[model samples]
Target: MTTPDKPLIMLVGMGDLSARVLTLLLGHDATSRVVLAGRDAETARRRGNLALFTAANLGRHADIRSVGLDLRNVAATAETLARVRPDIIFMGASLQSWRVITQLPKPVFDELDEAQLGPWLPMHLTLNHLLMRAVRDSGTGARVVNAAFPDAVGPVLDKVGLAPTVGIGNVANIVPALTHGAAHLLGAPVEEVELRLVAQHYFSHYVPRFGDAGEGAYHLDVRVAGAPAAVDHHRLFAQLDNRLKRLGGIDGQLLTASSAVRVLHGMAADSGVRAHTPAPGGLPGGYPVRIRRDGAELDLPEGLTVERAVRINEDCQRADGIERIDDDATVHFTERESAVMNRLLGYDCTSVKLGDCPHWADELARKYGEFAARFDT
Candidate 1:
């Protein structure tokens, strides 16, 4: 039912996360168009058919199509963006798999702590950076929604002036879970509970591993029925994790997809809807965001300064093993992360310079391949 004048949403990456987003969008709004683009047009088509069929079964219809695209090629990617001129671009392409990496041979992965997470930042940003570059070259004013490692990746791209409009998933995923917990504790409806969080990617792992005992200064304010709720943040996070075992990893495609869809719906409607999301306007970590037709802005709750929220997230990055991303695009991994990578892959990459991402990405891919093969049995 989409007409020529309706906005076109181009979704890159036909991975599981993108598929989930596509399915949800199709069912929710049949009047908009979606183009599923990836390296494999055939595969994208297959997925598109499934999404369409799912929509049909649900008594919904959508105008959806597929296109083949390779984001790694700068010129080709730019050409596609120029040709499409989409109003919105949802980037879900990534060289690494969340499932494969997270579930690496238990022994090898166990040796590395959260502070060692920075070494993989290059792999997460490669395609995302390329797509952002393509957007710049195309001269199209399309809003971008990055679906890959936004907590760490978004800031890197932002430093280079290529950050996406907003990133999907991350801290936003925790809001609803926490809201539900508060609602249950207060005996209030979920709709009546409002939770605002100021944190980063590390909290996603921290809550799952230690729950309330998780170390970090994350800002959490919960309100029920227009009054402050007296729920303990730690206990609420623990309750959330206990309620859902799939808070982390690719199993979270459900929450991530739904979060992105909410943003898209807000964008399409041009309403300044507020939602919790990671890296809105390309700042580090996550915050409450106000999405409107003009742009997305951080909506940090009362009593929190932008500087303070940023400091909180920056400090938590160490928990993920990343020291900092320099203005020159050099990503300095925590010493522990670098050592772990050196011991595991024999690759001595202490820091990843912006232009050298492809080399490090290739090396990491090779190392990860070997790691996966060894554990295949």
Candidate 2:
């Protein structure tokens, strides 16, 4: 059994999936310590009901308490890390609630920089960089597993020397659910199914809901490690259909959180997994990741070529902003996405790309400037 000093896990955020994660971690390995943290106990508890329900449904018998944490007080987070001496830290605290923009008139959104993914990149990436620093400062050998917008945030965190041990949740996260259904229909063991995906956020965002990608769902191929294997596309799609059915019409934040869970569970498994997230920690788009038992580490998993990854991201980035970004140059936030961010927070702020963690402290302040002002009581 791993002792207390061996390494505990620090989970930031008390959202539904965050608690679900705590429960899953305990159910998966009860001996290990799991810290379920957040800023407000009341809100955390309120938001954590789904997690609690999911835990009970899973029949998790271990005790995982809700820990309150104020992210604004960065030092407190540092203190928690110092105390837990965690082996793995999962940062799922930040909220990725950008669905509102989708509801606005396409004409208005299409014209603004907020329409692009880059503008608000700073909003999410800033939170990640701060937390990454806390994890690094902990100095324990704990590997950190990050959730949320890793396609952009993970890489930015990496550039400043505070990269996640591994990033969880991305396009790669959605592939497995498809793989399993294909495996079952083909009568092949799930392990034998191999999938190669070249996808972008646009597909990840709209496909499951609208099935509007125009590509007839996602194109997935399965094969035994070295041999070709048959796949049942209809059955495979049935699985995707079921998932979207359940997730249909739900709040975007809730759906994103659920997506977070699928990614988390896959990353937690025994076999190694590869995913694309924002790596080099400050890049414009996502970078691929390699996940192992101890923690997630950076490496563009072997199958896909770097050139292919870059080209896909560049295409996605262009669709996001009014001006297209250069494929080779690191991309940052866009004007439309930034406008949406301003409308949401009532401020105009920009995101720092992969190399800008040092500026994150200021950026976060600017991003949160209004909300903090209005709510300061």
TM-score top scorer: 1
Tell me the alpha-carbon RMSD of every candidate: 2.2, 6.6
- Best-fitting candidate, measured by lDDT? 1
The global C-alpha lDDT for each of the candidates, from Candidate 1 onward, is: 0.80, 0.53
lDDT of 1 by residue, 1-377 (tens): 32434568899999888988998888556225888899999999999898888888989877788888999898998898888788888988888855566676666666644334567777788888889899999998888988788888888888889889888787877777777888888889999898888888878656755556365558888887778888966667788558744546677778889999888877777778888777888888888888875457888778889999998989878767788889987888878767877776776787888888988899988887876687776
lDDT tens digits, residues 1-377, model 2?
23533234567876555655555555454223455677776665554454556656877544344567766566777777677565566777664434434444556544432344545554566667667666666666566656655555554455455666544444544566656766777777888776654455554554454434423123334676647666655555556656534442234344444444433443445335555443323343444455455543445435656666666665665455413422332445556656665776554555344445336535545655544454345
After superposing candidate 1 on the true structure, give the runs of residues whose Cα lies further than 4 Å from its correct spot: 1-5, 105-108, 112-116, 247-249
The ten-residue window of minimal lDDT in model 2 covers 321-330
Tell me the deviation in Å of residue 302 in model 2.
Answer: 7.8
